[model samples]
Target: MLLLSGCKVKASVWKWLHIAISCFVTAGGLLLLKHSGVVTGGTAGLALSLSPILNIPFHYLFALLNLPFFVFSYFYMGKSFTFTTIIAIAILTGLSSLDSLLPAFTIPELPGAIIGGAFIGIGLIGLFRNGASLGGATILALYLHRKHGINPGKSNFAFDFIVIASSLFAYSLTNGLISVLSIAVTSTVLALLKRKLATVKPGESRAIHPASVN
Candidate 1:
């Protein structure tokens, strides 16, 4: 992980732990997606939609495919974010291989999209709460926020809709539309909660806004 000059390495042990949990959540969120047969948006979602055509499991494909993006983030982003994404990718790969062991768990495409989208949205927000983000379009969204001073919610919404739209080729246009709707509903809920957590609440005891780290 990158550190500020004169900062000791020991300071990051806790951050590392948080990174690990964030990765786990990323994995779990993806697992939910595959089980539900919902085509999610994002690069991983792209990989997922193509997996069946290539006869590859989404998890393994995701791990391998995301490598380039991870490398890009490592160089252009920062060390800590890259480390978290690496762990996140590993966890997701492991989780994806479980299609057999957890063969019985099934979420209809609609419910799957709703629940999985909600979980994934909330998961990303949780990572951001810890002073990082989910590391996909999230990186670009950060860049947009810095470049144009756009709100985080607006940036995320635009990118997420793009991802969700790409699902049309994987599922029929109808199912794809359903998935988009589901993700939209949940993502909006998550964005609101993120803002709520950020601005501080009345009578708050311990506030943990992303800005606190800076």
Candidate 2:
């Protein structure tokens, strides 16, 4: 019982740390995207598009948009996975919203897109390693990758194309293209990292069950 209690404590600590790191990176990426006047794919992109039009907070919209996805995820990803995902999403939502309070800063479009995409990718890696996800297109991509042997990166990028294309209506063509570049960078990095992470031992706590985030 003592050993079991110790393990529980360790797991709980790991979960909180994972949530913090992922949320920080995700918030940083979203801030950059916002400053660059762009959007990427997944639930985040939807939130970005609607936030301005609906005049709602991005964090609230992000969490609300993911509600249905959570239900579906519970069925597909199992209870523990879905629960962790909820925690991850909640943290990300809160942190991303808090980022609005940060002093204004800006970056060049191309560099912002690249760096922001990488940050998002890093955040997702943390979430995935912790058996959590942002829940949206990411859930679908992970499901397909796990069950059908499809490349999640390609699948994710395919969905992103539609999301970025739709943004052309809301943003300039240049910005839309930059959004695509961000998504491309995100997907590519995720693919490479996923492949590398696959080689890690489960005992190391780096090979969690497949799940996805926005």
Candidate 3:
């Protein structure tokens, strides 16, 4: 009984931590978009675009939009990955709704485009390091990459372009194109950094000097 109880407690704590981390990354990515006045492809972006039309907060809509994908993720993703992802999304939704609490910071258009992309890229890679994801087109990208020998980066980029294209109807072709470039650059950087980080020494997180890995 004691052993069982301890295992359960550990599971609960892990769940909480995973959710917290997911929420942190998701909110961080959202903050980038908020600053840039742009959005990306994925269920979260879909929610933001439709929220005003549906009379809902972007956060709540994002959570709701994820339901079907969560079901797919649960079946398609491994149990551990899916389990944490669900919790991560729940916490993210809660945090996203709290946007009012965060100060609204905008950026100059060009700088915003570049910095916003970098922030989202790094933030996503952080979530990936923790063994989860925001889930959407990337999930589809993963499926294609695994099943068809397609490069994950290329798959995601193509899908993201589709997302960017859709935005043109709502915003403008120019604005839509910029957001696409931003997401592509960011996700590409994330993928590159992820590959480099994976081969480094264990128990060390170093993006700079590995001698600094202490």
Most accurate candidate by TM-score: 2
- Taken over the whole model, the C-alpha lDDT of each candidate is 0.62, 0.79, 0.63
Candidate 1 lDDT over residue span 1-214, tens digit each: 3566334344355455554565566656667777777776666677778888999877767666666777667776567656655665565567567656774776677777776777776666555544455456765654455446556566776776787676576578777776676667546755676553323211111223245545
Per-candidate clashes, comma-separated: 0, 3, 0
**Best first by lDDT, ranked:** 2, 3, 1
* Best candidate, lDDT: 2
Pairs that collide, model 1: none
Please give the lDDT score at residue 142 for candidate 2.
69
Instruction: Give the distance in Å from residue 138's predicted Cα in candidate 3 to where it truly belongs.
Output: 2.8
lDDT of 2 by residue, 54-73 (tens): 99988899998899998888
Better of 2 and 3 by TM-score: 2
In model 1, the worst 10-residue window by lDDT is 198-207
Ten contiguous residues with the weakest lDDT in model 3: 197-206
C-alpha lDDT (0 to 100) for residue 122 of candidate 2: 78
RMSDs, each prediction? 6.5, 4.6, 5.6
The parts of candidate 3 lying over 4 Å away from their true place are 1-22, 103-105, 144-149, 196-214
Q: What would the per-residue lDDT of candidate 3 be over residues 26-113, giving only the tens digit for each residue?
A: 5776666756777676776777677767888887788777778767766766666566566667777787778778787776555566
lDDT of 1 at 140: 60
